[model samples]
Target: MTKDVEMAARNGSNGAVAGEAYYPPPPAQGGDVDVDDDGKQRRTGTVWTASAHIITAVIGSGVLSLAWATAQLGWVVGPVTLMLFAAITYYTSGLLADCYRTGDAHTGKRNYTYMDAVASYLSRPQVWACGVFQYVNLVGTAIGYTITASISAAAINKANCFHKNGRAADCGVYDSMYMAVFGVVQIFFSQVPNFHDLWWLSILAAVMSFTYASIAVGLSLAQTISGPTGKATLTGTEVGVDVDSAQKIWLAFQALGDIAFAYSYSMILIEIQDTVRSPPAENKTMKKATLVGVSTTTAFYMLCGCLGYAAFGNGAKGNILTGFGFYEPYWLIDFANVCIVVHLVGAYQVFCQPIFAAVEGFAAATWPNAGFITREHRVAAGKRLGFNLNLFRLTWRTAFVIVSTLLAILMPFFNDILGFLGAIGFWPLTVYFPVEMYIRQRGIPRYTTRWVALQTLSFLCFLVSLAAAVASIEGVTESLKNYVPFKTKS
Candidate 1:
């Protein structure tokens, strides 16, 4: 029998491939080619490429809004909160790597769908609900990213004399236009026929991201508040040392958001490793991915967080734009804005891909004959576009851009969208994904001292996230209350 014919039979009439199925022979492996192209089967991602994905994914608009979020949590606790969260994120990612390895070894399924495994093993609707929430959270994350990118780019352009009036309202206008433009650009960049070569783009993106962040951090440290005549003076005491009790609680809760961000992407790192050609049996790829990812993310977080608190002192905000905008000579604002724009593009790619894929997946099932609306159709069109489709490949790029533009215009005013989204959406994806996966793989992850300690910490992290989500939503609502048009004054 032919290879396709055999797979079709083995896969059954419903077209569902069994989770426990093993690789058949060479011809069969080569025959079922939907997952990877010929070159893709041979291409493996490097440590640098994996690192880029992890770092970019974590450093979204949240990096920009972190200052504000931390401030809302309490200014005195801001930096401490960032550091505390960074530590949790680092450890949680490590624990996730261990869980992934254990599960893969036991299941003999190196390429397991995280949700499928979790859902099957946990056998709980809440687990599945969490997974669904994760997916939605990621979508919100993409929205947050694109909106932030628009605002950053607008701020950069205005500072560079691109905007004539330099109007505050223009920030929102420029942001919306950028959303449309970036969406178009992403369609092409994403459609690159040669993904192996695309690693170079990720490299350039990473260099831009890290280098700009480093410089921004440095400039922030060297900054001195000036008088009206522009004369510099020593001012702005160090922030976040010996914070008050309320500030301490705020910092702790903010830290939970950071942990959620890290947890959300652990499975992505594992997926990328598995996709590599001739992957390590000992799975050294997981170690490499995690080590580089955690280290890079931690360093950037520290640099941005510390310099920001130190420079602006009480005035500093959490977002990268805040760090970028607080520098002297004015021209630095343009430079910082530009860096944020470039870095945000790379970050947006990682955040948007899964949401786009999920939307495409549902579209395909719901409307099998919708032409280019399905993921399969988009892939085929992408093959034709060869990475620069302009407008043809993946039209949803335009739709996403439009949605993001509208969201950027509206939600940014809310000022706490990042924290709110991170709280409501990011928590389940990051905190619960690994724990649920581990529970599925090995019941309750053993009650050893270390495991028990981690679980307690994880549970605490969950509670913090729950509180943050609730508080942020309430805060947003309260802020909106002031803007609401009432018929009568109180």
Candidate 2:
């Protein structure tokens, strides 16, 4: 499969729920030709390429909040939590990879997407639930991206203001305005010709993610080595000194959600698996790739989160780059923030375009004869530089952008939002679905020790998600008391 397949499956996930079983179209008979059994070009992906894809998909702007999360959980719980989440993701990923082939791990019909696997193994209700999770997660991600990008943009402006004026000068930049500007930009990009086909956008976003993550790690390392670090404890922030007991509990819960968010890539694991060749079987290769990617990612996260905590223990900003953690090296900070804005611009489309396509596809299917919905008018600025514009496409995409931006404005609590998104996704997408699928596929009987273990694990994660959601909501409520819409500051 091409990278377009990966990007489509990355966010809005293939398409809507058709409420039917997924059966792969029969391959052409006597397929000993150049094409694979499925009649597509033979995949050339190796364990290394698969590993690279997994790493890129997992690490993103989400890593920026690790230090703050670490501070909430303190030294002991923080790293342990990161490692634990990594292990869980890795194990569940192997289970998911096994589900890629319906019957056998090596040679059953390919279930190309997560929904494909769920539809093949699970029930109709599961298919619908999976669709809801994928779509809701994609839309929430769009809104989260908007909020994150605007904060980075406002950080640049605020950094400039601080540099120009005295240290005490008010350098508050309105986050909601930046968010609105970003929404307007996305509205324009939404109409690009075959926007999903611009696979380079995904590459660019990955590069930007690495650049900022590297900058964050470097800055935090420098801060730690330079000495005079803040107070840090094995138990983390003090209950009475840094926060009240209730606030401590809330922060810990939110911290769990934040760490969960940092590892949010299981939704696309099957797509990544689909890219691999099958001499060694895609499942085996994907299992290796998951080990490499998750292990490497965990090490990187430890460096970023641990060093940032060492630099500003109990005071790490929710976002390392935009959170005013470092004032000097203003140029580097500005560049990092610029990279963030650029990355998110593409990453937004990486996710939201699938959503746009899914909705537009459903509309066309529903109203086949409606010209406004089904017809694409080829509008040209020049002979060769134009795209087919449809009224439904333009209006629906714009409305989506507007609504997401408005939601971001209403609740501009960055950490709280990230935590909430993570909590909502962690249980169902990462744990429940994969575990359930593994059991059904393997025909594990009920009340078996293995079955009980899986269910127990799922229940534990559900409790964590529940607690995280409550904490994030509480955090948002607390934030609302201080800031109104259009008034969030850098």
Candidate 3:
């Protein structure tokens, strides 16, 4: 049977003997392909859990900034650019799914992580490249979330402490203090044993995301309908379009980069897909999960971006929630900010898990017993935990949270940090790797039009990323011209 399976795999057909047909294959006899100590696999999720994970990872603080992005590009370019990103992301995500599987049923192999896939299809050097960008992007994303959560907490706190005359009664409670508080909370939640353990947290985070997004859209609609007449503008005409063509073009590219960043989840697709049950249909399941997740996210992005632009016109803040201030409808604003805080807590974990997994995997490979919890310790603890909370894991994860928190407190320009992350992360993780992997996996000819087009697209994405990096640096430099550390935003 094994020889036949190998032969069929070599022939590039489903693993069936000459006389036999490939019908529905039998269920995997093993409990799970990725089993734990008790001989049970942890792959116990369905499409819903997978969708929840994708949604939680994808629709983060990025959505909060889309209105400002829209304002930069105006309604026509903004919505169109967002939809374009959605399509491109969806297409490349399918390419990634194809790379996850190799060989035929009985003799097939699956990539357990993104780096695994990269190393398999590309080279070890490329794997290292992917890992570097992947970890940096994840860490940057977590820092962004820390800043967002701090902002939400500060808003909530200030709302509770405000007087009737629009003054913050407790002005001393700054964003940095709340950022520290958020970091402490994350240090606890970041200890979840594995990606599978975060399934429920992702679900709750998705719900929280939906709650705040709905509130944002509702608030925007209400303001547009009931507030001052002629305040909202659709075209750039009323908002006073950028007079200089060069400035207008730069803003357009910046918005493009922001949209690309908002749509990025390719970095963690394999990690999330690993939690799905093993079968012939795992790839299909993952594709469906991506479609469902992206569809839901794009809908919210469009509504929030369009409505937010309409409500604020050219005056939209980097964070749409900030537009509400600490005044009337303050309770709703507080509730929405609380939802954002809760959602980002889960988002921080979602992005950070891949980093933890990669570090632990590397440690295990480097030192055979590095990530292990000894039998003696397990017995003393009186529990059969699936993962080791060894000294390295405890120390590094804690330090990562601490460092990211400090960075957030030190540099609180949300949009600038996001632009920087998007610039550094978008090309390698989102565009270049996936397209190159797909072309290599399929043996596409180098000089063919398809190959050339994709390579061109990757180069274009790289240029956009570079421009965004420069713009972000300029923005940060302007903000920090005085170079004050740990300065809170007023």
Candidate 4:
């Protein structure tokens, strides 16, 4: 695996080299293997890594919350929305395949950082701006995960303690302490070497996947028993809210961020160019991977949407797992809490890795061989700016830890956090990045005159549908007021 990875990096036709190569580390001694505390040499991630990322990305809070996404358009549009999201994920993956091909053909360097790859080859400032947007989206994603995990932990402890002794409020303190402890642990581990140390992280991630699947299965079974004939029915009241048409349009437009997420994440293609065993010399492997990954993600989304709505019927909303009573017989709530925490921790690293690399690039450029600068630089500069350069690369690991912790503290509530997350972070990063990259790489005049005209009609349609999606999310708070099983009196 290591040899294959090295070969890909060496023979890259892409215009930019892997950033890791540009700042090469000292040569490793032959026959000397670095092993983690478990005495296992870090497996350079077999196919399992790819599978894990796909499942984790596909089955995040999105799947749990997708029922809410469908409610806006109506039950009829639910499957269709799943199809659309899947199609978009696949199409956007195609664009990334093209970028990877271009990099391989042009640079002789296969792997490039997201910004470096885009800026060096695509040659557009706005295209690089997409990287910035990706960072934002990732941070939002991390925050959502943290908040949800915290809520799950709280609810589980609350239910158990309340059941044992009729004082439920004590659960609140335990939940907060659990979240704080989790945050501190995240901060500590954020300093670990190589965010991509895949051994334990991969195992932990897979365990989480099983837990999520279990929760999904439990919900599916429960719904089946509750009322085999029960189905989600959308009434005019459910769909018709007070929001204006323009506002509705604006809201759906929010989903565009999903596109940006598709693009920036597509940069994982660069990693493929670096790793992956015996990837096709004709570069067909990348195309195949993209198709497989995106298709798989879409399928997962559809399943989640279908099962989630079916399970909750009219009650599904953001973090659908919460609607299931946070602590049921199958230990669903505790399982989800731990699993999501592990999943988000891994994702947070991936998201922050690029930022760290970029900052390191900046530091290197500014202070070439100045020993003092190198020594005191990370501390003086990083501490002052709230960046953690103590970690090997400050971008993904430490930065992600810091950002997730801070945001988790700030956005303590439920759907509010997810809604703000979808609107502010996910939409911009996912939607804008690819379009910006496409225009920048192709050139605005040509893109606008030729390509834009071709894609515009389709884009506008997506835009409108997405607008409806957003309106649906907006009306969710009111819908929640009516639908929640246990309502607090004013």
Estimate every model's Cα lDDT from 0 to 1.
0.51, 0.78, 0.75, 0.49
Q: Model 3: per-residue lDDT, tens digit, 1-490?
A: 2332222223221111111111111223455344522223446778899899999988888899888788877778789878977887888888887776554422356666777778767876787788788878888899889988998888887776674435735544568888999999999887765687898899999999999999999998898888752243444423234335655555556666677678878988888877777653567788899999999999999988888888887677789988866776889999999999999999899998877766554443334333241111121334433343445556778898999999888888888788788878888888888998899888999989999999998888788788878877776776788756776754
- Compute each candidate's TM-score over C-alphas: 0.73, 0.85, 0.86, 0.71
* Residue 2 C-alpha lDDT in model 4: 38
How far is each candidate from the true structure, as Cα RMSD in Å?
Answer: 7.0, 5.5, 7.8, 8.3
Q: What is the per-residue lDDT of model 4 for residues 1-490, given as tens digits with 9 covering 90 to 100?
A: 2342233223222232223312212123456555422222332443555555545554555555565454434466666755765665556545544454343443344334555446545545654465555556556666666666666566566667655666544444434455566676666655533435433664466467557756665676576577552346652014344235664444334323322232235434443333333333313554565566566656555565566667666555556566565345536566666677676566554544444444444543444453322322223344334222322343435555665666565545445445444444333333344454555556667555656763673465445435534643664555555543322111
Candidate 1 residue-wise lDDT, 135-230, digit = tens: 567666666666666666666555554344543433323345666676566655545322244455656666667766676666656663331111
lDDT of 3 at 172: 41
- Best candidate, lDDT: 2
- Weakest lDDT window of 10 consecutive positions for candidate 4: 17-26
Which 10-residue window in model 1 sums to the lowest lDDT? 13-22
Per-residue lDDT of candidate 2, residues 1-490 (tens digit): 2232222223222345632111111222355435455654466677876665566556766788999999999999999999999989988888888898888666688876677789888998998898788678778888888999998998888888888896788888788899999999999988753332445565676677778888888988887888667788888889989999999999999999988888887776776676678789889899998998898778879988898898888877888775444267888999999988988887677667546655765565455456676555656786556556667778998999999999988878889988998899888989999999999998999999999999999999999999999999999889888886676777
